[model samples]
Target: MTTITHRLPQKRHLVTDLPGPRSAELTERRRSSVPTAVGSAAPVYAVDADGGIIVDVDGNSLIDLASGIAVTGVGASNPAVAEAVATQAHHFTHTCFMVSPYEGYVAVAEKLNEITPGDHDKRTALFNSGAEAVENAIKIARLATGRSAVVAFDHAYHGRTNLTMALTAKSIPYKHNFGPFAPEVYRMPMSYPFRDDTGVDGVAAAERAIGMIDKQITADSLAAVIVEPIQGEGGFIVPAPGFLPTLAAWCRENGVVFIADEVQSGFCRTGDWFACEHEGVIPDLITMAKGIAGGMPLSAVTGRTELMEAVHPGGLGGTYGGNPVACAAALAAIEQMSSLDLNARARQIGEIALAALSSAAESLADQGHGVIGEVRGRGAMVAVELVKPGTTEPDPELAKAAAAHAFSRGVVVLTCGTYGNILRLLPPLVIDDDLLREALDIVIEAQTPA
Candidate 1:
């Protein structure tokens, strides 16, 4: 029989073993110098990626279910992305949007304002990463409201910075020895339906959190209450249905800026443009990054024009905030997302994942396997937490095992959650159905008894 080759936008060429020879060499080189903690995720040796497949240094290709930590949604190596990048690179790269502005940067901000959730007169400020976007959100809120206190939630994963670390939930890995973190950042209990006590009903979890901030954090001096509609790294944990709107309502009443950290959940990764739109709640400020620039480094804080304008001149920019190439890539990425209907595609992907994940979890339960206890998330940002089963206790060791097992089978998966027991998937939206199913099957096969 002859082989028929189809030119897939995403390429997969398993020329050598997983991690291949060159990848192993690079890993060894890094192990000698880089910190041990940073070497955990897939050994970081991919040389190229396109659409949904990542190719390693030694010519090994694996399905990239972890889309650069949920960054590249339009697809890896997209023609639009590449063309935009190349065109911008040819025409001068950086002028520091602050020192001298450019059309590309202004256009990107305009696009964000028009597309981001919230119909009010919105504005945007670009930055280098999600962390910086979040930092600016705090600054804008403080300057606008004349308040110093900021409120976050338990089990939330905002970013990795002085202020953001204080906003984040975990400490051992992201925050340990990195603090004394920024002050006046208070954490309220998030409404984790999976583990919430009856003291706060699922539907009223937002009210409960608001009460905490009101009673404990003191809204009198509060600048903002920031939240991820679907908590990302703390686990792909979706808040209860009414939680966001209720929280937003309280913020409105108390004059606290409602900041939505949509870095991980925005740009069609969720069913909507922004996760906050799931409940028709328009936040005072929204921070975004990750999937914005087709894998390029870019982020933005979009919000009410009045609030954004509150920040004085020369207070909100970076040397590389809106790099022209990155801005061009982002414009192309947004166009691609809208043209391809990736938002709807993301919802469909979630449906596919939900059915397969539930069935696989049930099979594992029947077989008495001690991994994959629960599946939860919205759209393509789905997760399954590994556990000992029939208990609330987390099983990080089993999660690590499942991740390694998936990598061994030519699939790249990432693990998150405060306990580090949740395995999450973030395949590019352009991935073909067969490839997605293939990756899911690989994950299933990895869980079977050996």
Candidate 2:
């Protein structure tokens, strides 16, 4: 197939093996300098990336379906975002918001407040990462409500920080041996419609969870209830239809601050500015990162004015909470997203990918090797869970093999899920339709049994 011409040419071309000689050499050098703990699925050294392609040092072009873990919604090297970063770097790089406030910081905060769900008076606090934003959100909630316990759902991946680690439910790589973690965080059942054998609806899921919370944790003792609108690292699990709204309503009635951790699903990745908007669920606070700055390190906690104001001025800031360059990039990224209407593009991508994947799954199922257990997601964030042919048992080996096969064919795919049986696709929102379809085809072909 001919490569589509773009910034880096949206195409997949294998000049050599998957981790060609150049990448292998770099990997050897990296082993000596970088920690073994920091791992990556795509074992290649990227020299240039743009649109939907990541070019390695060996001249291999790989279709990017992961989008740098959903960071580059506009694109990996979006012209506007790159220009903004370079321009800001030329003027000034640091000058942290707490040390010397800049217009860029305030402007980005304003944009976040305006775009996040709800028109009620809200405030924004910038942070360096999703973990920091989540930690601060808990701090604010605890202070405002004078409560100790916070509720997090199962199959949740908040972050890796101490508090977030406590909130996260994974055990192997994320939370394993990282304890003793932060205290007073409780875990509850999530509304995973796909895995729910009882066939519970959205409202039923919410009621079941609320019953547990009421029985275990008293209303006045809880500080907040935090959840991902669409659980990202936890298999891209999308809660049932009415689950989020029901939970948000319960939180409001009980005065527990409701927080939507949109780190992975925000910024038009899930067809909406924020995933919570899909169900009209208005949270007291929203934690954002990943796609906020077009791949730059920036995050935020935007919330109701009253809850935010409850925190003292000096109580909620870090040294580099809102670096000038990052804030500038965020402003440009938001402008680019709005101008390009990336939200609609995300929805379009979802429609095409979902239909194709559903059809493929059905065909494979008829063949008696029904590996795809479920295909779920919204917008550009989609996933295919691999399971045993005749049972619901997770097949991590099959998922791993499919991802490896796609990578060998010059398509970058990411595997995730608590059981490591999910293949997630998060192509850049600005990806060309042809390239997107081509990448999806490669993945589907890889999953087919020999």
Candidate 3:
């Protein structure tokens, strides 16, 4: 069913029940066919999505707060984006960028160079997913630095590919049965202010991690040190103020490249154009995806020109890497983000969201039954890790219950983190104050003293 919602005062129509009788029947059928993990997030299937709401086959409209896991920065069904995609599709689709060079793909590269951080000459190679971008970054670093070892922080999530899985911190869902990952991957503790004690502050945490690397993986043997300015699935963690700069300085001093994985926190999702901009540390490579092309499957690796040149001719290319249609959509999405001041808008949304959720946590703290252990993130990319209390313990039960309660109503939220105890909110920046407040109400009610 196609959804029609124009302008403000968004209308939510639930012609059927939450799952409706038809959807329930379809879901039952799905159990026999599809893997159960498919429906783990929201059992209710999405029939249609537009603006900031998802309409189910049962005709239940849900206010989307997950933004497709922070992929759709500019609303779900942007008219301009739709027009761009349609226009490009009518003309042509694929011509492997490496085989037959195209203007659209080159234009995207030029745009990435101009938009990405740093005044140094930058180069970009388009990819199909965040994992691809990350893998490419590792390859680039290895080739440029002529080293085999890479240092990654604990709680970091790069991607799901073999190499990326080795880089990823958690091993439950992403790396459970899969074995024998890429070599030269090292994981170290992060600047988790919420967890550490003693005087091991944020910069101190970086120092500690760096000290370990200095002793174990010498800079002479390391290719790069990959990090996330604001960890996405790892509890929405925001590292200490000087952590990134300190690490970057160490990398520069030791002849190791610094790669920032901004897949989840880039493209205006974190108020800044990229989370790395929060600090002026220009990395040797930056992997980006998610909101890069609005809702389209687009990812890129922007890097120093000389470093990117290390790759051999025909070393990197994909048929769908820069499909013209997706490129056109990306152009429109970037235009929308700039003209609409979405970066500033992201800050506004984040400020309001933090205020509301933090207030709720404080209220419960007074009662000694608080679940929101900590609220941490930058700009609109925010999360609340639920815990029993006074401890860093993960509260998966509360998080699951909160998510289910939101789904039962009309709000769609996503639960993430290694522990699956973080309630992540990625509402479209276009969401109205009223709708946002209403969604907040649902969250509060779910955790209320019922």
Candidate 4:
């Protein structure tokens, strides 16, 4: 397949005030028609997006650093993905893989099995969302191990489904009143270097969590230990070095299935095919989504063949799982990743972003504006934590203000973290270097207080 370049000028341009007239009208319509529960980062409504730029309804072009929350790593409206979806839709939109299997579904499964970590024989089951993939992975673990308990980490985000909500660490928007929550799920302390008051290294931190698990939810009764290799919505928290390897090793010793939730960190988003690769940890079950299908709604649970096959036939599937159009998009996206060497591109983006953010953080600290706590992440996934000046106390207000400032200036950035004090950048791996630098400059300016 030939590479298709973005057509829009790769620069940010503002034609009207942030929302403009059209977007403001739509926002009003949304107030009455759509629920207030569904929130959007940008006030403007997007009409077209490609490469690293989003064109809003009033033709205001905004630099896209959020990547649709890391869904469009190859770029939103990727021509190759669009072509694949069009061709597949023309042939047949959906027969429901359960009713009548198609090559596209099987092809996606085959590709997932080949790409996900581990050389051991593996199998993949598809789903419609990351939550669905995570839910199924838990089901498979429970059935295979005949255990009832599961372990999750503090500040980890699995998904929003019942089981996943229970797995998720945050409580406000995700689990506040929504849950009586699923039982048999336990949370352990994560190895957060920035917030670790104990000052433990990766291996020691792993021991702390392991000790808690052994005492609280004994390994024998644990079905699986699920964690995001790099926690996404929980603030792009990359675990300390040796942390993942230690946890995986303990899981192996105890016979508990180890699951890596790579939903936001998979498919070359983190400089590797999966974030787990950075730590050299092979999970028994790996859940994937987001970048898998180039913005299509598709997710997968890929794992050891023995564990996956243990489930009875017809035990795993859904109505829209692996839709043909989505599968075709996945195939095209994977091909694009390999052919374009997006993994290397992600590394390049990471280097540039890390250097810029780190410098900004240092400069801010020198200027006595210590609100920029720490800048951390890998590959194209980067973030800056905000804290009160001269203290470790979280400053969520500062984060919100910075993001709003960026949006006002025609750049699309996002905020995350349990305390809501992290400004994250997830620009498309295919973004132009100059455009990325310009967007980062805006972000840095936003971080600086007047």
* Strongest candidate by lDDT: 4
Candidate 3: stretches off by over 4 Å: 1-16, 37-40
Clashing pairs in 3: none
> Across residues 1-450, which tens digit of lDDT does each residue of candidate 1 receive?
012122344545567667777877887888888888764688648767776788777767788899988898887787888999999999889888878889999999999999987789988999999999999999999999999999998888888889899999998788999989899998888888777776665458887777777688688899999999999999888887888888898889989999999999999998789888888989999999999999999999999999999989988988999899999999999998888888888998898888898899898788777467678888889998777766778988877887898898779999899889888999988777778888888777766668
Q: Candidate 3 on 1-450: residue-level lDDT in tens? A: 123244433545567657778778888999899997554577677767776778777777888889888888788888888899998888888777777778988899999999999999998999999999999999999988889999998889998999999999988888898989999899999988777786877789889998899889888999999999999887788888889999999898888999999999999988989998988888889999999887989999999999999899988777788778888888999888888788988898888889998899899889887777898778888888898876778989989898888888878888888788989988886666667788877877777667
Candidates 1 and 3 compared by lDDT, better number: 1
**Candidate 2 Cα errors over 4 Å, as ranges:** 1-5
Global lDDT of each candidate:
0.86, 0.92, 0.85, 0.93
Candidate 1 residue 184 Cα shift, in angstroms, is 0.2
Error of 3 at 115 (Å): 0.8
TM-score of 1: 0.95
Arranged by lDDT, best first: 4, 2, 1, 3
Residues 35-148 of candidate 2: C-alpha lDDT, one tens digit per residue = 999999999999999999999999999999998999998888888889999999999998867878889988998999899999999999999999999999999999999999
TM-score of 4: 0.99
For model 1, name the residue pairs that clash: none
- Candidates in descending TM-score order: 4, 2, 3, 1
Q: What's the count of clashing pairs in each model shown?
A: 0, 0, 0, 0
Lowest-sum lDDT 10-residue window in model 1: 1-10
Worst 10-residue lDDT window, candidate 2? 1-10
